[model samples]
Target chain A: MNPAYGPNPWQQTSWDARAACNFVFGGVGAGLIVFAVLFGAGGLALKGLVLAGLALVGLGLFCVWTEIGRPLRALHVFINPRSSWMTREALSATLLFPAGLAAAAAVPGFAWVAAGLALAFVYCQGRMLQAAKGIPAWREPLVVPLIVVTAVAEGGGVFFVAAPLGGGGTPPLDALLGAMLLLRVLLWFAYRRRLAGTVAPPARVALDAAGRLLQLAGTLAPLVLIALVASGAASGAAAAALMAIAGLAAALGGAYVKYALVTRAGFNQGFMLARLPVRGSR
Target chain B: MTRWAMVADLRRCVGCQTCTAACRHANATPPGVQWRRVLDMEFGEYPDVHRAFVPVGCQHCDDPPCMDVCPTTATKKRSDGIVTIDYDLCIGCAYCAVACPYQARYKTQKALFAYGEPIASEAKRHDDARLAVATKCTFCVDRVDAGIEKGLQPGVDPEATPACVNSCLANALTFGDRDDPHSNVFRLLAENQHFRMHEELGTGPGFYYVWDKAAG
Candidate 1:
């Protein structure tokens, strides 16, 4: 990891950095598990992804306030917690992560239990974004299902590269990934069709950006994952190297999708633009 | 059942900004930030353009989203309909600012006090330091409180009927106990069926605007 990516030196080690780390990991981690469980082969590698997701959620609770004096004050959110999903997200993540982690890190005998916990965490994460009334894009009806599908697709891409037929897990896993990827394509159509109705320009832009990235990942990444997984099954060292490269691409592509959603696609320009009238339009 | 309210007659409101000036004086609000803003609304176009002065301020809604969304119990609805903010408890998050569809809340900008004492010296002071929390019309809470202490009606005072209502040369603005049927506001409400801003949102704002037949 680059030093630039590390925690800033000026702040307290346990405060801002912890919060930022929690947000980044919790967001990325749960997202990964959701993708994995939905798309990836059910096995030891899927278990690892689930554990990492839970860890991120646990860390998110530990570091709730990124730039506030009192972290304990976050408890007040529960007062109107019925209306405020931020509070619910906090509490759900607190429980979900630990349970999911235990399940993921468990022996091969209890691996199925861990996958179940990961599944629960993903649903809660979807609901959390749904609760934020301020962001129109996040609050959309399509967002929840799309989030789940995206998570599974990304997870499958990772699992495909890692798992070999018969040796790693069940043969049905590959078919499941292919099905999930196909479902993702269906979701892509659904999201775009819905976007056509949204009058909010910024929201439209953000959805388009997210939709484009997912389309790229769905089209190219899965083929690479399958190729690498198949090659590794036939050859040995060279195939493993190819599999590693394919995994990296999937991971990078996943990051790109997230980046598009969280940063560039989050164009709240409509809010400001609403304050102005079109001057040039005749 | 303390329904503190205001009634503004748009017919008499000349858009002269007298009420705006009076509010600015009473609140001693910093430059640019007005507790009450007079919005100039233009209808039709060209030769048919007719302007109406819409005085915008905190409506003190029955179901305020600001109070609902506030993370801390900083903003509360008084027993009276006045929505008051606890400055000490406010974390300055500005969530209420956005939640308010009216855009009633204004954050104190650095430009509000760029010249420090020199600019402030020219302006009347109301203990509003440079970077204070959100400010809005209090329905003259201080006056209403003082009047109640003096054993008078809750909202009426000889010296203070809210600076805007008092200073209105056209006598367009009205303030009284909305619960009292005999009150001028209640009678006006009965007669005119005044318009409430953004009535569709179900906020049930206390402020009512009586649009005159000629004005409309």
Candidate 2:
């Protein structure tokens, strides 16, 4: 490896904690909006969840704005749809907020519209990271699916956590959460293996640690909790409490993984020289 | 129809770093920000050991990732193939910095001088407009444009050539329009075995390193 400005095993510092927060809040918020509508939230419950989701998404965007050096010129972010994923993301947000408010107001089929737009918002976020061709971990083909799936899993997790406000988590929603948790863990392993040779050693180590947390706290614990709720093994307040704990685990664990993905594992693509020149070999 | 390019004859280079210093001086780059980096490399082992100084910077690629990923359209490519960043339009989001595979883009938020405060020379040349924005080597576009306005040839004229190429003591660096068959860069390229860095990424880099003189 070369020294300082050279071909060192470079870790990208351009997008740090600020960028990570965008993924954390934006993914979960978008997920929350979709899952709440899908699970049939109604009246005040529907309004509350949709508005809360929109607020989280807005806060995430605000954090990103704070990170920008020239925040005043930020509207220029919408200028490049022909080539930029970031531009697409900004454009998607323009439609998402109105749909979310309409759904919150219990407009006939606007809930579904809100759900669909939220899905697009989250999908744009995934593609945004994957478009960074220089960062090996982000550029992997599996990054898009992993981001989308994890966000869905987080959405389900939050639904269970906020169940009391809406009637409660149904058996079907519990099963869906279990399935998403399983899928997330499996996808993570596949993604990790695919990037075995590409990432720097430190990045690999950090990802491995996150993977362990993802499987244990995010996947296994939640799976067991959801099983208890589904099988009538837990009831009444016991069931709600258990399911809520599992949701917290799922939400927090997935957030940690995304944080790690954006901050810890974003090593830049260093150069690879196939041949070295000899000094005086004329 | 012109594509400007730089050719480096690796065998003739002695790793003196004159080009590096000349480039920094000419551009007035901030501390810890080097647009041109000469990576010292050692290859092989023991008795058969070989060494070379590999130079890297913005490739001025045909399909630059920096331009494609720039949310503000601040990064643009000229018809002549030189990639440039419009300081006025940039929002300093640093998206282009991460998109660049060469690690060529930099974003400095403040005016930092080399010796604590601005020296006499630094005070006169520092560009405050470059602060809080993405920056990289432009292949000295200003000099090229000015030289052209004066009806002077870029690659052939000492004043119009990039400072690094003009300051190279080993005569390893050459700059010219690659499309011009009569240019020195094209002649050197036609007579030597050369390769562009990270060519597999399909960047179509304008910088070429001539490795073997006999292969052509």
Candidate 3:
């Protein structure tokens, strides 16, 4: 055996705590920024929210980097700068940060373009983890697309809940919520298939819990959304309250999933041998 | 127009993180960042384990996702196929952060000024200019441009060979333009069992990995 291999039988180190910190904070921050866009707000506010979200996400990813090494030299992924998703992410972030500002500063369609690109930006966060070839939970094909759905859905819900508190509303807003909820349900169902065969038992249990919460959230979203669509034309506060609850549920549920994903039981093959001793050997 | 690429012979890579450190110093990157990370993936059962040191980075694919999702056109693809970024215009929104499959982009909460100025701390002075922006690797564009001016290889900026490339102690990393049939990177791609990180996403990464069963 190669002595330089560090420790053998190699035990894979699990840094799920750090990963969860990165995932939840980034996801929530991003969802909030995107949510701000749906409500009637200027580009300046949108830009600030997006920047705030970016800060949280950057801090999270930075923590992940420190777990490895020097954070300053993080630019090495761009050496080839062609096929690397990290590079793509870096490049996209470089543009998205400013483009969001430009959109905030621009007129009409430009703001929409910035918001649309922000949606794409959130999608990449999900894809980054989904692309991980090693982790069974992360490797599922459905993971990436589902992450997009959850990000948007949760983002929308968070937006609605916070919108009124900030003194903002529109007629079609609730309709948008209904649509987002529907998409989340569909994506959840689609992701169910991959969850069965690939995921570990602990992860499965945590996901099941999260799934149940989402279903409950999903059921209430439509009612609130449709009522809000009424614009004081329907059940009034009851609908608003329902939608608020749904949004809260979705946010909490998504956070649970993120936490579960990082904290759930799994093994890294590298660090195993050191953890468990041989049958008769020391 | 230069298309950069690298091939890592897993057999020769000692997993010493020389390339990782090399990348750090080459870029003068600030802190808590890594352009190249050596992921040691260990597979198999408890007693029969196997390990692999996979050096992952930007693929520089023929179709880059970063460019597709950039809202401000800040990320521009040059004629040579290098996906680059413009820092001045960034608003630090982090939309691109969400779009990336590789988790490559980073948001700058505060600016690193000419000297030791804390831009975030000095937000009142600069109108909060430094706190809201995004930053990342440019693939050493300054070096590439200088190399071109010197009549040297386009991507072969000797002074700025990307920390990871320069740090490979076992000579695992080979960098050159893939478009040049005679270049070292092309040759590595030509005569090796090469695979890329997450090829299914189809970002078409320029970085390749050559596996060695003997090393396992």
Candidate 4:
């Protein structure tokens, strides 16, 4: 196999920005479902959040549909759930969409089911990345946990920002978002460490830069904002504004992390020819 | 009960790329798509430099990650050990392309030609179903199957063999059933020290490289 020279060589991550959107939007959507189920105070606020989550998920699926080379054959994506994580993700969405809609419509006995399916959808997304064995960075065991934690963190961040827009805020959500951020930061560190040790040098360099950006923008910045909110250092209106800004940073940072991993850091294990011809006598 | 395998003797390979040309002609692959390729590697310092030619393609592993990740069940391994793709069933999601460790798969979305001209031979064999579908070498399954139906052996009969193996000018390439004790590949394995790429990953590749210390 030829050595992968130069920065940003062509890789085997056939899934492009559309696939990244599918994972990001779907994860955030699912996270919103879980957030509403746990902390929503009912009325239009809860309904709006639920509807937004459903739309985001629908949009994400549409993005994947557009990414497929043969869109007319996309229903085949649901055919192999027994083996393919992509099929399982599609199957889970079939349950999630209707359940989410029912929850948004204030139907009884649907919120819990929607929340459960949302979590399942997030899990399926992680598994899909893990199953891509050719990409050494994604195939790491840490990827599953990293993706799950980041999804929840992004979801919490979205809720924090969007909830304030409706003139509603929850104290528990602030604490929850803080905890998710902490976990996400820790997992990001561990995942990057493992990747740094194992991936090719070129990929490691890319991952290292991505990791530093995520640490500062995705982890530390939100952490400081969350601390200010928790310390009661700001007035009520000021705190809401700070929380919303923090939420945006966290959400954008999480999306950047996913985008970098999926696009920039993703690299296939290049071909390997084990033996070298002996020196001289050519 | 057959386990098809290929062996390339490093000492005999000349890096002439005849096998690459033959494979391209046999498959009628579009430009920039090579189902079989010879990789040239240079080793040692300038004064003592030597080059080794490595022929690479799909190993058709016992545990094929591509097969496992296919959302539409489009990739499957035959009982005889050849991995095949069902292009009709493939949605061209390219999941299998990234999942393959060997980088064996290719997806050609548009028709491309060599030398900026659509060659008559390529146009004649153009397959629309192949567009956007993942494709790779099949070890010449069509020839193997046809020859088997006619009671001919694969490694011994030119008509039944893979184009790459048949086209090897220096006799570096060999194809046979690894499970057969008397097969040429089995004999080569017994006489030469052999290695498979990424064996640590536990893919159990059907392709092998035979090396002799004396050749160096």
Each prediction's Cα lDDT score? 0.57, 0.85, 0.57, 0.83
Over the stretch A1-282, how does candidate 2's per-residue lDDT look in tens digits? 422122446689999899888888888888889889988878888898889888878888888888887888899999899999888878877788999998887788999998888888888888888888788898888988898888888988888888876767778888888988999898999999999988888889888888889999998999999888888999988898899899989988898999999899888867766555545656
Residue A257: error of model 3 in Å? 9.0
CAPRI quality band, candidate 4: medium
**Model 1 Cα lDDT, one tens digit per residue, B1-216:** 668898877656667788888887777667777777666655556986555566668888888866766656667899778898776555444546535645677656333542565364444453543343555777777777777777777435645468888888887788887888878788877766357765655678888877633222
**Candidates sorted on DockQ, descending:** 2, 4, 1, 3
Which CAPRI level is candidate 1? Answer: incorrect
Number of clashes found in candidate 1: 7
Q: What is the lDDT of residue B179 in candidate 1?
A: 85
Which digits, one per residue and each the tens of the lDDT, describe model 2 over residues B23-141?
89999997888887777876666997667787778889999989998888999999999999999889898888888888898889889999989998999998878988899998988
Docking class of 3: incorrect
Kindly list the per-residue Cα lDDT of model 4 for residues A1-282, writing each as its tens digit.
433211222455688888889988988888887887777647677788888888888998999889888999999888788799989999999999899889888998788889899889989889989898888888998888888878878887888788766784767788888888889889988888777645777777777777777778877888898889889897578888888888878888887888778877778766665665332322
Order of models, best TM-score first: 2, 4, 1, 3
Which ranges of candidate 3 are over 4 A from the true structure?
A: A1-187, A194-207, A217-282, B111-132, B154-163, B212-216
Compare candidates 1 and 4 on TM-score and give the better one.
4
Q: What is the DockQ of candidate 3?
A: 0.03
* Top lDDT hit: 2
True-vs-predicted CA distance for residue B42, candidate 2, Å: 2.7
> Candidate 3 lDDT, tens digit per residue, B1-216?
468776766657667887766665565544555667676766567899866666655555566666654445556677766677666444343435434445555554544543576445333344333234444555666776676677776424465455566557877777788878888877766765556654556667776766532121
Query: What are the DockQ scores of the candidates, in order?
Result: 0.11, 0.62, 0.03, 0.54
Which candidate has the highest DockQ of all? Answer: 2
